[model samples]
Target: MDNIDQIVDARGLACPMPIVKLSQAMTGMEVGQTVEVTATDHSFVPDIEAWCRKTGHQLIEVNEAEEEIKAYVKKTK
Candidate 1:
Protein backbone atom coordinates (compact mmCIF):
# COMPACT_ATOMS: atom_id res chain seq x y z
CA MET A 1 0.00 0.00 0.00
CA ASP A 2 3.05 2.23 0.04
CA ASN A 3 2.32 5.25 2.21
CA ILE A 4 -1.40 4.68 2.18
CA ASP A 5 -1.94 3.51 5.68
CA GLN A 6 -5.39 2.98 7.13
CA ILE A 7 -6.88 5.55 9.48
CA VAL A 8 -9.49 4.62 12.08
CA ASP A 9 -11.12 7.49 13.91
CA ALA A 10 -12.34 5.96 17.11
CA ARG A 11 -12.84 9.39 18.60
CA GLY A 12 -15.98 8.92 20.73
CA LEU A 13 -15.69 5.18 20.76
CA ALA A 14 -15.58 3.12 23.89
CA CYS A 15 -12.81 0.91 25.29
CA PRO A 16 -12.74 -1.99 22.84
CA MET A 17 -13.93 -0.03 19.84
CA PRO A 18 -10.61 1.63 19.21
CA ILE A 19 -8.67 -1.57 19.59
CA VAL A 20 -11.21 -3.59 17.65
CA LYS A 21 -11.04 -1.18 14.76
CA LEU A 22 -7.30 -1.34 14.85
CA SER A 23 -7.39 -5.10 14.65
CA GLN A 24 -9.82 -4.98 11.76
CA ALA A 25 -7.70 -2.45 9.91
CA MET A 26 -4.61 -4.56 10.20
CA THR A 27 -6.28 -7.56 8.68
CA GLY A 28 -5.49 -6.65 5.07
CA MET A 29 -2.19 -4.90 5.68
CA GLU A 30 1.30 -6.05 5.05
CA VAL A 31 3.64 -6.83 7.87
CA GLY A 32 5.18 -3.38 7.95
CA GLN A 33 2.06 -1.40 7.22
CA THR A 34 0.74 1.19 9.66
CA VAL A 35 -2.60 2.37 11.01
CA GLU A 36 -3.49 5.65 12.65
CA VAL A 37 -6.25 5.49 15.27
CA THR A 38 -7.67 8.54 16.98
CA ALA A 39 -9.69 8.27 20.14
CA THR A 40 -11.30 10.57 22.69
CA ASP A 41 -11.35 7.92 25.37
CA HIS A 42 -8.41 8.84 27.55
CA SER A 43 -8.52 5.62 29.50
CA PHE A 44 -7.72 3.69 26.34
CA VAL A 45 -4.21 5.06 26.10
CA PRO A 46 -2.52 2.53 28.34
CA ASP A 47 -4.93 -0.18 27.33
CA ILE A 48 -4.14 0.22 23.65
CA GLU A 49 -0.43 0.33 24.30
CA ALA A 50 -0.61 -2.81 26.34
CA TRP A 51 -2.67 -4.51 23.64
CA CYS A 52 -0.07 -3.57 21.06
CA ARG A 53 2.68 -4.96 23.23
CA LYS A 54 0.90 -8.24 23.65
CA THR A 55 0.09 -8.48 19.96
CA GLY A 56 3.63 -7.69 18.81
CA HIS A 57 2.66 -4.60 16.84
CA GLN A 58 4.85 -1.54 17.07
CA LEU A 59 3.46 1.64 18.56
CA ILE A 60 5.06 4.30 16.42
CA GLU A 61 3.84 7.51 18.02
CA VAL A 62 1.28 8.98 20.38
CA ASN A 63 0.00 12.53 20.35
CA GLU A 64 -2.45 13.99 22.81
CA ALA A 65 -4.55 16.86 21.66
CA GLU A 66 -6.92 18.94 23.78
CA GLU A 67 -9.63 16.30 24.07
CA GLU A 68 -8.31 13.28 22.24
CA ILE A 69 -5.36 11.03 21.66
CA LYS A 70 -3.74 9.97 18.41
CA ALA A 71 -1.96 6.66 18.23
CA TYR A 72 0.17 5.41 15.36
CA VAL A 73 0.73 1.70 15.17
CA LYS A 74 2.53 -0.52 12.70
CA LYS A 75 1.06 -3.90 11.81
CA THR A 76 3.55 -6.65 12.38
CA LYS A 77 1.26 -9.28 10.94
Candidate 2:
Protein backbone atom coordinates (compact mmCIF):
# COMPACT_ATOMS: atom_id res chain seq x y z
CA MET A 1 0.00 0.00 0.00
CA ASP A 2 1.04 3.56 -0.67
CA ASN A 3 1.73 6.02 2.13
CA ILE A 4 -1.58 7.30 3.44
CA ASP A 5 -1.79 10.92 4.50
CA GLN A 6 -5.05 10.38 6.29
CA ILE A 7 -7.39 7.63 7.31
CA VAL A 8 -11.16 7.99 7.29
CA ASP A 9 -12.89 5.38 9.40
CA ALA A 10 -16.38 5.17 8.01
CA ARG A 11 -16.81 1.55 8.90
CA GLY A 12 -20.12 2.08 10.66
CA LEU A 13 -21.35 4.81 8.39
CA ALA A 14 -23.78 4.24 5.56
CA CYS A 15 -24.03 5.23 1.86
CA PRO A 16 -23.28 8.90 1.56
CA MET A 17 -21.65 9.25 4.95
CA PRO A 18 -18.47 7.62 3.83
CA ILE A 19 -18.32 9.83 0.78
CA VAL A 20 -19.23 12.83 2.86
CA LYS A 21 -16.44 12.24 5.31
CA LEU A 22 -14.04 11.57 2.48
CA SER A 23 -14.91 14.86 0.83
CA GLN A 24 -14.59 16.69 4.12
CA ALA A 25 -11.18 15.21 4.73
CA MET A 26 -10.00 15.91 1.23
CA THR A 27 -10.92 19.55 1.60
CA GLY A 28 -7.96 19.99 3.96
CA MET A 29 -5.56 17.81 1.99
CA GLU A 30 -3.20 18.90 -0.70
CA VAL A 31 -3.28 17.52 -4.19
CA GLY A 32 -1.51 14.16 -4.43
CA GLN A 33 -2.23 13.41 -0.77
CA THR A 34 -3.78 9.99 -0.23
CA VAL A 35 -6.56 8.93 2.14
CA GLU A 36 -7.60 5.48 3.18
CA VAL A 37 -11.29 4.95 3.86
CA THR A 38 -12.48 1.87 5.64
CA ALA A 39 -16.22 1.34 5.40
CA THR A 40 -18.60 -1.44 6.26
CA ASP A 41 -21.23 -0.38 3.76
CA HIS A 42 -21.09 -2.55 0.69
CA SER A 43 -22.41 0.27 -1.46
CA PHE A 44 -19.26 2.31 -0.76
CA VAL A 45 -17.36 0.55 -3.53
CA PRO A 46 -19.43 2.12 -6.27
CA ASP A 47 -20.17 5.26 -4.29
CA ILE A 48 -16.50 6.03 -3.70
CA GLU A 49 -15.66 5.20 -7.30
CA ALA A 50 -18.37 7.53 -8.56
CA TRP A 51 -17.25 10.30 -6.22
CA CYS A 52 -13.67 9.97 -7.44
CA ARG A 53 -14.80 10.06 -11.05
CA LYS A 54 -16.91 13.13 -10.48
CA THR A 55 -14.31 14.96 -8.43
CA GLY A 56 -11.28 14.03 -10.57
CA HIS A 57 -9.61 12.23 -7.68
CA GLN A 58 -7.59 9.07 -8.13
CA LEU A 59 -8.85 5.81 -6.71
CA ILE A 60 -5.59 4.06 -6.06
CA GLU A 61 -6.69 0.76 -4.57
CA VAL A 62 -9.73 -1.08 -3.28
CA ASN A 63 -9.79 -4.07 -0.98
CA GLU A 64 -12.80 -6.04 0.17
CA ALA A 65 -12.52 -8.10 3.28
CA GLU A 66 -15.11 -10.26 4.99
CA GLU A 67 -16.34 -7.37 7.11
CA GLU A 68 -14.83 -4.23 5.70
CA ILE A 69 -14.28 -2.41 2.43
CA LYS A 70 -11.15 -0.32 2.05
CA ALA A 71 -10.42 2.28 -0.61
CA TYR A 72 -7.32 4.36 -1.07
CA VAL A 73 -8.03 7.64 -2.85
CA LYS A 74 -5.63 10.30 -3.91
CA LYS A 75 -6.65 13.87 -4.46
CA THR A 76 -5.96 14.99 -8.01
CA LYS A 77 -7.66 18.33 -7.92
Candidate 3:
Protein backbone atom coordinates (compact mmCIF):
# COMPACT_ATOMS: atom_id res chain seq x y z
CA MET A 1 0.00 0.00 0.00
CA ASP A 2 1.49 3.35 -0.98
CA ASN A 3 -0.32 5.85 1.18
CA ILE A 4 -0.59 3.84 4.34
CA ASP A 5 -0.63 6.32 7.19
CA GLN A 6 0.45 3.89 9.86
CA ILE A 7 1.69 0.34 10.15
CA VAL A 8 0.75 -1.92 13.05
CA ASP A 9 2.91 -5.01 13.34
CA ALA A 10 0.93 -7.38 15.51
CA ARG A 11 2.85 -10.41 14.35
CA GLY A 12 3.41 -11.95 17.77
CA LEU A 13 0.31 -10.58 19.46
CA ALA A 14 -2.65 -12.82 20.01
CA CYS A 15 -6.41 -12.47 19.73
CA PRO A 16 -7.91 -9.16 20.89
CA MET A 17 -4.54 -7.50 21.30
CA PRO A 18 -3.92 -7.28 17.58
CA ILE A 19 -7.40 -5.94 17.03
CA VAL A 20 -6.86 -3.65 19.99
CA LYS A 21 -3.74 -2.22 18.43
CA LEU A 22 -5.47 -1.82 15.08
CA SER A 23 -8.30 0.09 16.75
CA GLN A 24 -5.86 2.37 18.51
CA ALA A 25 -4.13 3.14 15.24
CA MET A 26 -7.39 3.92 13.56
CA THR A 27 -8.35 6.44 16.19
CA GLY A 28 -5.27 8.51 15.45
CA MET A 29 -5.88 8.50 11.71
CA GLU A 30 -7.92 10.83 9.56
CA VAL A 31 -10.71 9.75 7.28
CA GLY A 32 -9.36 8.24 4.03
CA GLN A 33 -6.13 7.32 5.78
CA THR A 34 -5.04 3.73 5.92
CA VAL A 35 -3.35 1.39 8.36
CA GLU A 36 -1.47 -1.82 7.58
CA VAL A 37 -1.75 -4.55 10.17
CA THR A 38 0.09 -7.84 10.26
CA ALA A 39 -0.77 -10.55 12.72
CA THR A 40 0.25 -14.15 13.34
CA ASP A 41 -3.02 -15.38 14.70
CA HIS A 42 -4.80 -17.22 11.92
CA SER A 43 -8.17 -16.50 13.44
CA PHE A 44 -7.51 -12.80 13.05
CA VAL A 45 -8.62 -12.97 9.42
CA PRO A 46 -12.27 -13.41 10.24
CA ASP A 47 -12.01 -11.22 13.30
CA ILE A 48 -10.70 -8.33 11.30
CA GLU A 49 -13.35 -8.81 8.65
CA ALA A 50 -16.05 -8.77 11.27
CA TRP A 51 -14.52 -5.68 12.82
CA CYS A 52 -14.59 -3.84 9.51
CA ARG A 53 -18.24 -4.73 9.05
CA LYS A 54 -19.13 -3.56 12.53
CA THR A 55 -17.11 -0.34 12.38
CA GLY A 56 -18.12 0.66 8.86
CA HIS A 57 -14.47 1.04 7.94
CA GLN A 58 -13.24 -0.12 4.57
CA LEU A 59 -11.13 -3.21 4.42
CA ILE A 60 -8.95 -2.79 1.40
CA GLU A 61 -7.10 -6.07 1.34
CA VAL A 62 -6.30 -9.08 3.44
CA ASN A 63 -3.70 -11.69 2.48
CA GLU A 64 -2.50 -14.72 4.34
CA ALA A 65 0.83 -16.21 3.37
CA GLU A 66 4.05 -17.55 4.82
CA GLU A 67 2.26 -18.10 8.13
CA GLU A 68 1.42 -14.42 8.44
CA ILE A 69 -1.61 -12.38 7.62
CA LYS A 70 -1.53 -8.84 6.33
CA ALA A 71 -4.51 -6.56 6.29
CA TYR A 72 -4.98 -3.09 4.91
CA VAL A 73 -7.80 -1.01 6.32
CA LYS A 74 -8.92 2.48 5.53
CA LYS A 75 -10.84 4.72 7.89
CA THR A 76 -13.95 5.90 6.09
CA LYS A 77 -15.72 7.44 9.05
TM-score, every prediction? 0.89, 0.95, 0.96
Query: lDDT tens string, model 3, 1-77?
Result: 69988999999888889999999999999999999999999989999999999999999999999789999999999
Q: Give one digit per residue, the lDDT tens place, for model 2 in 1-77.
A: 86899999998987789999999999999998999999999999888888888999999999989899999999998
True-vs-predicted CA distance for residue 3, candidate 2, Å: 1.2
Best candidate, lDDT:
3
After superposition, which runs of candidate 1 have C-alpha atoms over 4 Å from their true positions?
Answer: 1-4
Instruction: Give candidate 3 misplaced runs (Cα > 4 Å).
Output: none
Please provide, for model 1 over 43-67, each residue's C-alpha lDDT reduced to its tens digit, 9 standing for 90 to 100: 7789778988999999888887889
Candidate 2 vs 3: which has more lDDT: 3
Ten-residue stretch with the least lDDT total in model 1: 1-10
Q: Global lDDT for candidate 1?
A: 0.84
Per-residue error for 3 in candidate 3, Å, reads 1.1
Cα error, residue 11 of model 2, in Å, equals 0.8
By lDDT, the better pick of 1 and 3 is 3
Candidate order by lDDT, decreasing, is 3, 2, 1
lDDT of 2 at 7: 95
- Give each model's whole-structure lDDT: 0.84, 0.92, 0.94
lDDT of 3 at 32: 96
